[model samples]
Target chain A: MPVALEIVSPEKLLLSRPVDMVVVPAEEGDIGVLPGHAPMIVTLRGGFASLYEGGKVTTKLFIAGGFAEITPERCTVLADEAHPAAELSKAEGQRRLAAAEQAWEAVDKMDVAARDAALAALQVARAMVDAAEAP
Target chain B: MPSLKALRIRINSVRSTQKITSAMKMVAASKLRRAQVQAEAARPYAERMERMLSELAASVAGNKAAPRLLVGTGKEDTHLIVAVTADRGLCGAFNSNVGRAVRTLVQKLEREGRKVKIFCLGRKGRDFLRRDFADRIVGDVSFAGKRRIGFADAEEIAVRITSMLNEGGFDVCTLVFNRFQSVMSQVTTEAQLIPAPPPEAAAAPEAGSAMRAMYEFEPDEETILARLLPRNLAIQIYSALLESAAGEQGARMTAMDSATRNAGDMINRLTLNYNRTRQANITKELIEIISGAEAV
Candidate 1:
């Protein structure tokens, strides 16, 4: 059975397709769901989400922290900031990564919320770069 | 008689003021363009979010186990007003218009014997409400240094509001902001945040006894809704901020343009007065010299 997935961000709809499986970066860890997977709603961390379609991996998306709803038949992802890995510029990603690291080093200066936000941004930046390089 | 040096100094000052006003008008025009773009870009997201929420809320409204955020507490005794305004106040009546609308609502709510607490988003709003609703103010958030508004700021506000909700702080939450309709017209609007206004009527699916569409909830309706509700709030707040930014720029542009024209008019009138005074002075000197020569 094919699973219908709709990937959304506040700015625009990133993707809508029927795919065989989806690998989501849940808050806990990477969660891969095939058809007939258990109904679950998982909080997503900032990372790359891979979609498998028609027996081949079709696309990779970089998602900022958000939430995902996975039913037995469909998956819906609502993200704060989501973009196709191809859309992100390599230089910008690298710049964000560097900024995130600097912010992380000074994490103690920031409040708890700021630290978490910095971490999330760092994760998203790295994930985009990594996904672009991935086979 | 006034010294010529004094008149010269006055004229120079007016010229300087004219220059300043003209420069300000140009700056405001450029800022308005950028602000308009930001506001327009945010509309699609806001509209989409509303559509999604309405669609989901329609289904959830029928379910008994829907989260309290969606269903609301069903009591409106206590009210929380989130006032959105520009931190800076140069724009003519832009912040004050929103402030006035909020004031009217606050008065009306108080008259009805409802308890109203305010969470002010900008410094100008806070300043205005301080004299009247000082005791009712719970929190104040300002983006004084932030050149542009972002989701992170809205998320911070959402987190604070949600925690208050969880703690039973207020029964209803209302957002007051200036809705950007056009460059000339910005209508102030008050929106109810809690329970999300029951989704638009047209968005509700038709009532069909024969057709039953079953929705499978992931984790559970309550759980997903609990998380989604806060995100929706954040997104809405972010959208409001964007709208305010754009509205402020438009208002500033109009205000500055008018000011520049007024200054030009003032300068023209003053220059006419100065030239007339100089011409009269020359005529008086010529007449006195001729009369003295004839008498001699």
Candidate 2:
């Protein structure tokens, strides 16, 4: 039995299909979902979610921070922002990394929330560059 | 009576106006279709998000540690109203309806001794409300140059609102915009935004089979809710913007269509009068020539 995997962005539903396997970047770590996986809802960090078919990764998407709910039969990913590997640009990723680094430095340390946000953005920026450069 | 030349010119002018209005009508119609399609495309994500949220919120409601976005600060003294309108006009009462509704709401809130601050999403709305409640206007944003609005724009606004919430600017927040009902009708809707309203018992499918499934939380519910609430805010703003965009295009289409039809009718009447005047003038000329010849 295949698990129904859905990836949704704020703008639109990016993907919804039955796949053999789905790997999501959960806040704790990467969670690979297969049929009969226990039901769970996890916060997603900024990374790629790879959908596998016939033992091969068919689609890889760069998802920004959001949440994902996994059930035995279905996995739903609600993302703040999602872009396909094809859409991710190394140049833009490099620029975002530099900007995120500067922002991480400039964020007020007194504001813990701001510092955390800056750190999350920096991690996401780094991930974007890695994903774009990955073969 | 106006001369035949004047009547002809009047008919020509009305005809030209008709042409322009009809063209505008067609343009608006196509634009409305595009907006509607965009709204449709965005519906699935919103529905899924709302469904998951309603379920989670049902469990979390009344909890002491609920996030502020889920359970707002227990004060109603200060109100922040977000009025969404179209940047451009000529959309009949689309802009004015929201404006008037906001004005009435502000007056009522003031009478109740609640301080109200308005955040306008369009220029037309800002202009409309600036007349009486100018002091209440806190901020205004307009997408005049952008041909299309994206989720990023809505997120930007959501971030600002979040910061404002953090600053404890207002105890309550309400969003006022025209809800797209159909091409012929747009309902002026006021929805509470700050404290996500509890899902109506009958309206929400909380009693459904899916809600009963025992789903475990990875990082616990509180942390996920904290993250989810902000994204939900952005999604709400996005959908509201999409609805207003579709409504604006619909209003423009309807207004332009009527103007086109009216211009056509005017041209028709003008042409009839011009032809009648031309025929009468010809009859007079022929009668004078015959009478002169007869006298000679």
Candidate 3:
């Protein structure tokens, strides 16, 4: 039996379909799931999540951060931010990377909490740049 | 017995006012459509967030280590009331209704010896409440010039409230806004924010049974909840803002429609009076002419 995979962002649902396999960027590491996986909830880090069907990659999305809820029959990713990997332009990614780097340099003036937020944003920006450059 | 010219001028002024009101009604109608679409689109994500959070919260329901956001500060002496209304005021009683609801809540809480703070979201509400509750007003946020409401605006307000919560400024938080029912009707609603209300039991049994059967937590439930509770607050605020925006537009449309009709009625009455006065003047002039001819 195929598992239903759904990728939902706060703005909208980006993807929902029955797929053979799904790979998520869990906080611990990238984890792959097949049909009938045990139910679990895990935090996501900034990275790309790929969906597989018919033993081939069907879709890839750049997820900023979010949570994943896994059920026996469904895998739902509630993302803070998400976009199709293919739609991310290299130029735009580079621009964001430069901005993140600039912000990181100036993070010293901010309070510890603000600095941490900036650091997280920088990490997400880096992941987005990498996703945009990947084939 | 006003002069014919004065009555004619009044009728013309009313006709122009009618035109303006009708135009405003059309504008509000278009705005309402967009607002309604955004509100509807936002529901799915907000509802899903609530559902998922409730499931996670169910696990840590009675845990000693649950986040302060869920379990609260263990006191209910202080209250923060977030009142949402429209920035502009041509919307009939929309702003007043929300303001009145908040006022009533504030009075009741104060009567119970509970401290209350008012966080006014829109200018109209702030102005309305200032006359009575000026000392209790803490924050006055206005989107006076914005073309439309956005999630970022809501997020900013949420962040402010969260910071206050962290500072132990308030023990309880409540949101008062108008819920969009239809173009002609809106229901004022008050929802508890801090110490987020547990998911309704009516909605829990089936999902709870399924979730309990198979769910493992990573990095423990406490950490996930610590991050999620704050986010849940933001999401709830965002949804409330969307509903308020839609309700404001709907109320404006209905108000303007009625205003246009009322103007039409006034114009008709003024025109009738002007015609009657003119006829009377013309009859008097003819009678005087005949009387003068007979005297000659």
Query: Which candidate leads in TM-score?
Result: 2
Error of 1 at A73 (Å): 14
Task: Encode model 1's per-residue lDDT on B39-70: one tens digit a residue.
Answer: 67666556655645654565566787676567
Best by DockQ: 2
Question: How close to the true structure is residue A102 of candidate 1, measured as C-alpha lDDT?
Answer: 88
lDDT of 2 by residue, B42-121 (tens): 88888878867876786676799898887788899999999999999989999999999999999899999999999999
lDDT string, candidate 3, B1-296, tens digits: 99998888888888888899899999989999998888887776677677678778878877987777887798999999999998998998999999999989998999999999999999999999999999999998999999877766776788899889889999999999999988889999999999888788426586577757567888678767866776688788888887888899899989999999999889888888888998999999999999999999
The reply for model 1, stretches above 4 Å from the true place, is: A1-8, A11-46, A51-59, A67-77, A83-135, B1-7, B62-65, B201-214
Candidate 1 clashing pairs, residues 3+ apart or interchain: none
Per-prediction TM-score, please?
0.78, 0.95, 0.93
TM-score of 3: 0.93
RMSD of 1: 5.8
Here the TM-score of candidate 1's chain B is 0.92
Specify the highest-lDDT model's number: 2
Which of candidates 2 and 3 is the stronger one according to TM-score? 2
- 10 residues in a row with least lDDT, candidate 2 chain B: B200-209
Cα-based lDDT for every prediction: 0.78, 0.88, 0.85
Give the per-residue lDDT of model 1 (tens digit) for A14-127.
788889999988877888989887756667777888999887778988887677767778888878788787777667778878988887887774465456667777787787
